[model samples]
Target: MIYDLLVIGGGINGAGIARDAAGRGAKVLLVEKDDLAQHTSSSSTKLVHGGLRYLEHYEFRLVRESLIERERLLAIAPHIIWPLRFVLPHDKGLRPKWLLRLGLFLYDHIGGRKLLPPTRTVDLRQPPHGAFLEDRLTRGFEYSDCWVEDARLVALNCMDARERGADIRSQTECAALIRKADSWTATLRSSAGTQQIEARAVVNAAGPWVDAVLGQSTPDKPHENLRLVKGSHLIFNRLYDGDHAYIFQNGDGRIVFAIPYERDYTLVGTTDQSFSGDPSGIAISDEESLYLCDAVNEYLKHDVSPGDAVWSYAGVRPLYDDKSSSNSTVTRDYVFELDKEGGAPILSIFGGKITTYRKLAEHALHKLGGFADRSWTADEALPGGDIGASQFAGFLAEAKQRYGWFPADGVHRLARAYGTRIDRILGDATCLDDLGACMGGDLYAAELEYLVLEEFVIKPEDALWRRSKLGLHLDRHAHARVADWFAARKEYA
Candidate 1:
C-alpha cells in the first residue's frame, strides 16, 4: 500500500502538514525519529505573536501571515492558545518610541485582529506591571500576542491526523528513502525493528536535520540549505504577580521576553547565536545565560542572576540560510522546495515559526499539487478544543461544578491539560480515590494511562516533559515511580 504523503520530522510543521493532508483525504504517514517536539518545537519562546521584532528586519509578509494565523489559532484551540498582553518598556538606548509605535500600528492593522485588543501605551510607574520594573523606565507599550503549549500543539495535530486515517509514528526514524519513478520506498528504523513503506511523495520537514534526511534519499541531493541558530531560554521563579508578560529591549539591538509561565515561573530568554553541532542535547551556554540575565536586569528593579534559573532549555532554529550577517536577521518564513527529479515528489521544508505552522502546511500541500482544494483547518478545532460558546474558563467552571469532589488545583490542571477531553479520563469517578494511584503532584494513574494509551507517550520523559509539564511539579521520587510504572507496562516494553 502506497501512502499519498509521507512526512518526515514530528515537529509542528510536519505534524501540521500530515494533519492537513489527511484532512484533505490523502493517505498520509508521518514518522518522527524521536518523541514529538523533543527539540526546536518544544524549546520555543512559546509565543504565538506575529514576530513583533521581525518588523525591524522588514519581514512584513511573514509578520502579516503570522498575525493572521495567530487569530485563527486562537479561535481553533482556545484551550491551549490564549491572549497574552506584552508590556514593552520604552528604552531610549534601543529602538525609538516612534518606530515602536509605527510597528505596533502596522501589527494591529495588518493581521485583521478581532478577538484580541489593539496596542496601547502603558504607564510603568503605576501598579502591577509598573511595580517590578526599574524607576528609569517611565512608560511602555502594551500589545497582545499569545501563549501556546508548543509540544501539545504538535501532539494534537498528530492526534487529529490519526483520527483522519493517517498513521502517526513516533520513536521511529527514516533510515533510508528510495525514490522510484512514481513512488518512494522508505526504510523505517525503531526499537521494534526496520520496515519499508511505500509512499507517493515525501516531505522533508526534518527541521535542523532536514539536509541530513535529504541526503538519505536513493539518489542523494546536495542540500546545504539551513542556517542553524541557537535560541536559549531560562525559567525562574515567578518575577512578577500578573498574567501579563514583559518584552524588554536590550541595548545591543535585541529583545528579551519575561513571561508568566506554568503559573509558578517566569520564562525569559531567546539569544540568537549561530550554532554548529548536534541538534540533540543542546544546553544553554554560560555566556548565553549571562546575556539573558543582563538583558532582563536592565529593566527589573530586582536583579536576576544565572543562579536564579531553576530550569533552562535551548533549541537550534533551522532557518533558511538567507546569508544574513547576523543570525537574528535570518527569515522566519517557510520555504518549500519541491523536487520531482525523475522520481516521486520530495518537498523539503525550511524555516517556519509556530504561529504560521498551519498556513505552512497548507502551502506545502498546495505545492505538492494534490489533495483537496478547499482549506479546512482554519475553521476546524483541534481535539478537545471544541468547548462550545463558553470557551476555556467557562468550561472549567462547569467541570469544577460537575466534579466538586476534586481539588481545585487538580481540576484546573486537568482542565488546562486535557480541556474538554478531561471527561474521558475522569469518566464516572466522583472522588480522588477512584482516580487510581496518585503518581505525585496532580498526576493520577488515570491521566498516565490516557497519555500512554492514547497520546503515544512510550517513554517516561514523553509524559513527564512533552505531554505535560508534570516534571516541574513532580519530585525525584515521583519521577522514579513514573519510570517504574512505564517499565512495568508490557506495552511500553
Candidate 2:
C-alpha cells in the first residue's frame, strides 16, 4: 500500500510531522536512519525557550511563536515538560538590563501566559536562589521557559505516531528515492537488507541530511546557499543549588547556557562553528569545551574543570545560509523549499527547533497542499499522554489507590513519566512483584516489555538513553547485564 505521505527523518520535526499527518487520517510512514533524535534533537541544550536573545536580532516573530508554544507544550506534557526559570546575570559588557527587561516583557505576553507567571527581577544581594552568581553581579532577571527530556520527546512523538496508525521504521535508511510519475518510491536499507516503499508525497524532514535526501530525490535542484554548523555541550555534576538555568554573555558576541540537568548535573553548551564535513561527523572541540568551562567558572562560585565532565555530545544544525558574517548571527528559523515540477511534490525543510516544530509542520504540510489533508493535531494528545479524562495527578492518585500494592515510589515514578498513561501501563499490577522482573534502578521487566510491545524498544540503549535516562541511574553491572541480554536476543537488529 502506498502511504499518503512519507516523511524521511525522525527528529522532532520528522516525528512531529508524522504524528500530525497520521492524526489527520493520512496513512503516514516515518523512517529514521539512526535512532530518533540521536542527532540534533537530543543534543540540544534541552530548553523549550523562546530564544529570548533573538530579540537582539529583531526576530520577534520567531520568539513570540516559540514562547507561546513553550507554555502550551508544558501544559500538555507536564510529565516530560515543565516550567523552568532562566537566570540572566547582568554584565555591563553585554546589553543593558533595561533592554533585557524589555525583551522579557514582550516574552511574558506572547502565548500560554495564563498559567506560568511573568518574569521576575532578582537581586543577587538577597537571600536564596542568587548566591551562585559572582559578587560583581548585583542584580539579575528570571523568567519562565520549559525544560524537555529531548530524547523522550522524540520517543513520545514516535509512540504517538504509532498509536495514530503511522508506520515507524527506526534504524532504517532510505537508500534511494525516485519520482514515479505522480508519486515517489523509496528504497529503504537495514541490516536485513533493502525494501521498497512508495508514497504520494515525500517530506524531506531530515535535519543535517536534508540536502543529501534532496540530492537523491532531486539532484537537479541545488541549495547553493546552505550552512551546516556544529554545536557541542558538556554535562557536569551540579555546580549550584537552584532550579533556574543561567544565561551568560561571553566577552565575545556569543552566549552560553548553564542549565540544571538530570536533577544533580549541569548542562552547558553550544558553539556555532561552521562545519563542512559529514553532517553526522560532529565532535566537541577543545576550544568549545574550554570556552564553556571558562564561561561557567566566570559566573559560579564553584569552578568546573574538564575533568568534571561526565558526558559530552555534539550535533550539526543545517541552517539556511543567509551570508551572515557571524555563525551566531545566522537565523535559527526554518525555511521550506518545495519541488512540484518533478511529478511528485517534495518539500524540504531546513533549520527548525523542537519548540516550533508543530507550527513548522502545519505550514510545511500546507505548502504541500493537495498532497495533505486537514490538520487535526493542534490540540490532540500524544499516545500515553492521556492519563484519564480528569486532572492528570488526580487520575494518577486514583490508579495508585487502586494499585496501591505496588511500591509507592514506582507508582509516583509512572505518574511523573507517563502522566495519565500510568493506568494503561500498569494494567492490573497491584504490587512490585506483579511488575514481572526487576531490571535495575526502578527499571522493571514489565516496563521494558511494554516499551518493546508498544514503542520500538529494540536495543538496551534505546530503553536506557532514549526512552528513559536510566543510564545515569543504572549501575555499571546493570547496563552491561541488560546490554548482554539484548545482544544475545538480537531483536532490535
Candidate 3:
C-alpha cells in the first residue's frame, strides 16, 4: 500500500506526529527501530513545564510555547498528566531573589495561564519546607508544573494513531530510504523479515538517530547536526515526606530536581554531560551519580550518596548543535530540516523537550505542508483521555466505588494508568479470580491482555518498564513470574 506519510522513530516526537497526521485523515506508517520510548523519550525528567531556567538563556519563545502546550497536554491527557508543584529554594548565592521573582512572573503569565494555580511564596522555616530542607534556607517559591508518565504518553499517542488508521510498527527499522521524483520507497526490516513500502513523504523523527537516518537518504552529506547529551537520573527511597518536589541550584549554575516518584521513591536526577559513544544501553555514570548526589546534598538536610540509589537510568538527548560551549546551555527548542532537494520531501526533527511535543508535531505537519486535511489533534483527547480534563479525581473516586471488590490502591493505579479505560480491564469481574492469576502485587493477567491487545506490548520489559513502572514496585520473583507468563504464552501460541 502506498501511504501518505512514513514516520521514523517511536519516541514522543514520532508518535505525536503520527497521531496528529492520522487524525487529519492521512494514511501514516510509524516505524521504530526498538520498543517505543526505549530511549530519550522515556528517560526524561518527566515533567510537563515551561523550562524556567530557559528564561536566563532568553529563550522566551520556547518557554511560552512550552507553557501553552503544558496545559493543553494536561487537558487532553489528564490521567497521565497532572499538576505538580515545585519548590525552588532561595539560596544565598546562585540566582538572586528579584531575578527569580521576575522569571516566575514571566513563566506564570506568558502562556495565558489557566487551569493551574499561580506561583506563591513560602516560608522555608515552616512545616513541609523546614523539615525537608537545610536550616540555611529560609525562603522558597512554589510554582506549578505537571508530571507525566513519559513512556505511557508515547504509547497512548501510538495507540491513538493506530486507532485513527495509522500503521504503528515497533521493532521495525527503516533501513533504507530511496527518494523518487513523486514518491519515496522505504526499506523496513523487522524480526519477520524485510520489505519495501512507498509513501508520499517521510518524517525522520528518529530522536538520537536523526543524523543516521538522514545519512541513509543522503549518503554524500556528513550529518553532524546532533549533539548527543546524556542525562541520567537516580531513584532513591523517598528522600522527603511531602508530595511537592524540590528544585535545587548548584554553584556551577546547573539545577537538579528531587521529585516524588511512583508513590514510594524520590526521583532525583539529570546531569548534562557530553556523550560521544553509542546511545544504546546507556546507564548513569559514576561522575553523574556523584554530581547529582552533591547537588541534592547542597539543598536537602538529609544527605545522600550514590549508594543510596535503588535504581538509575540514562538517555541521550539528540539536541541540535548550536555551537554552544556547554552542554547545559544547548537549546531545548526543536529545529526541523526540510529537504525537498533531490526529489520527494523528508523532514528531519532535532532537539525538543516532552513539554512541547504536541506543538512540535503540529508544527512538523505544517512544515510538511499538504500532508493533512486539517489540524485536529490539539483540542481532541487522546485515547482514554475523555475523562474530562478536570475530572480525573472524580473518575478515580467513582471507579473505586464501582470496582469496590478490587483493592482500592489497585483501582487507583489502574484508573490513573488507563483512565476511563480501566473498565475494559476490570470488565464485570466480581472478584479477583475473574481477572486471572496475579503475577505480582496488583498486576493481573487481565491487564496484561489489555496491554498486548490495546497498547502494543509484546515483551516483558515493555510491560514492566515502559507500559508501566511495575518493575520498580514488583519483586524479583514477580519479575520472573512475568517472564514465565510471556514465555509460556509464546510457547502455547
Candidate 4:
C-alpha cells in the first residue's frame, strides 16, 4: 500500500507529525528503530516551559511561541501537562533583582497571559523559602510553567495518530530510501523481516540521527546541521518539602532546577555541554554530576553529593547549530530542511523542543505543501485528555470513590497517567484482586495489558521508564516481576 506520508523516528516530533497528518486524512506510516521515546524524548527535564533563560539570548519569538504552546498543551492534556510554579531567587552577585523581575514580567505577559497566574514577588525569609534555601537568599520571584510526562506525551500522540488510521510501527528501521519522480520506496526492517513500502513523501525526524538519515537519502552531501548538546539530570530522595520548584542562578551563568519528582524524590538537573560521543551511550559524567550538585548546593540549605542521587539520566538535544559560542546559548527552535530537487520531497527536522512539537508538525505539513488545507490538532484533545482542563482534581476524586477498593494514591496515579481512560483499566473491577496479580507497588497485570493493547508498549522498560516513571517507585523484585510477565506473555503467544 502506498501511503501519503512516511514519518521516520518515533520521538515527539515524528509522533506529532504523524498524528497531525493522519488526522488530516493522509495515509501515514510512522517507523521507529527502537521503542518510542527510548532516547531523548523520555530523557527531558519534564517541563512544558518557555525557556525562561532564553530571554537573555533575545529568543523572544521562540519564548513567545513556547509560552503560547505551553498553555494550549496544558488545556488539551491537563492530565499529563499541568501548571508548575518556579521560584527564582534573588542572589547577591548574579543576575540582578531588577533584571529577574523584568524577565519574569516579559515571561508573564508575552504569551497572551491567560490560564496561568501572573508572576509575584515572595520573601525568601518566609517559611517555604527559608526552610529550604540558604540564609543568604532573602527574596525571590514566583512564576508559572507546566510539567509533562515527556515520554507519555510522545506515546499519546502516536496513539492518537494510530487511532486516526496512521500505521505506527515500533522497532522498525527504514534501512533504505529509493526516491522516484512521484514517489519513494522505503526498505523497512524489523524482527519479522525486511519489507518495502511506498510513500508520496518522507519526513526525517530522527532526533539525534537526523544527519545520518539524511546521509542515507542524499549520500553525496554532508549533513552537519545538528549540534548535539548533552543534558543530564539527577534524582534525589526529596530535597525539599514543597511542591514548588527552584531555579537557581549559578555564578557561571547557568541555572539548575530542584523539582519535586515522582511524588517522593527531588529532580535536579541539566548541565549543557557539547557532546561528541555516541548519543545512545551518553550518561551523566562525574564532572556533570559534581557540577549539578554544586549548583544546587549553592542555594539549598542542606548539601548533597553525587552519592545521594537515587537515579540519573542523560539525553542529547539535537539542536540546530547556528555557530553559537556556548552550548547553553544555542537555539531550541526547530529548523526544517526540505529536499525536493531530484524527485519526491523529504523534510528533515532539526532542533525542536517538546513544547512546540504540535506547531512544528503543523508547519511541517504546510512545508510539504499537499497534505491538508486546514489544521485540526490545535483544539483537539489527545487520547484520554478529554477530562476538562481544570477538572483533573474532581476527576481523581470521583475515580477514588468509584475505585475505592484500590489505594487512593494508586487511583490518583492512574487517573493522572491515563486521564479519562482510567476507566478502561479499572473497568468493572470491584477490588484490587479484580485488577489482576500485583507485580509491585500499584502496578497490576490489568494496567500492563491496557498499556500493551493500547499504548504500544513493547518491553518492561517501555512500561516502567517511558510509559510511566514507575521504575523509580518500584523495587528490583518488582522490576524482575514485570520482566517475567512480559517474557511469559511472549512465550504464550
For every candidate in turn, the CA RMSD to the true structure comes to: 1.3, 2.4, 0.8, 0.8
Q: What is the TM-score of each candidate against the true structure?
A: 0.98, 0.94, 0.99, 0.99
Q: In model 4, where do residues sit more than 4 Å from their true spots?
A: none
Q: lDDT per prediction?
A: 0.90, 0.82, 0.93, 0.93
Q: Please provide, for model 3 over 360-457, each residue's C-alpha lDDT reduced to its tens digit, 9 standing for 90 to 100.
A: 99899999898655768778997789987789989999999999999999998998899978989999899999999899999999999899899988
The 10-residue segment of model 1 with minimum total lDDT is 216-225
Tens-digit lDDT string for candidate 1 (324-345): 8888878888888889998898
Runs off by more than 4 Å, candidate 1: 218-220, 388-390, 491-493
Q: Which TM-score value belongs to model 1?
A: 0.98
- For 1-493, candidate 2 gives per-residue lDDT tens digits of 7999999998999998888887777899999998888788877888888888788898989998898777667656777777778888788878887898888898888554765778898887676545677788888888888888887788888888888899999889999999977899999998779999889999998888888998999888766556888899998888778787888888886889988887778889878888887867577988888989998888887788877899888888888888889899899998988988949999889898889988888888888876346766656666555532225567667767887777777776777677766666777776778876577767777787777777687788788877777787789988987777667556554
> Runs in model 3 with CA error above 4 Å?
none
10 residues in a row with least lDDT, candidate 4: 273-282
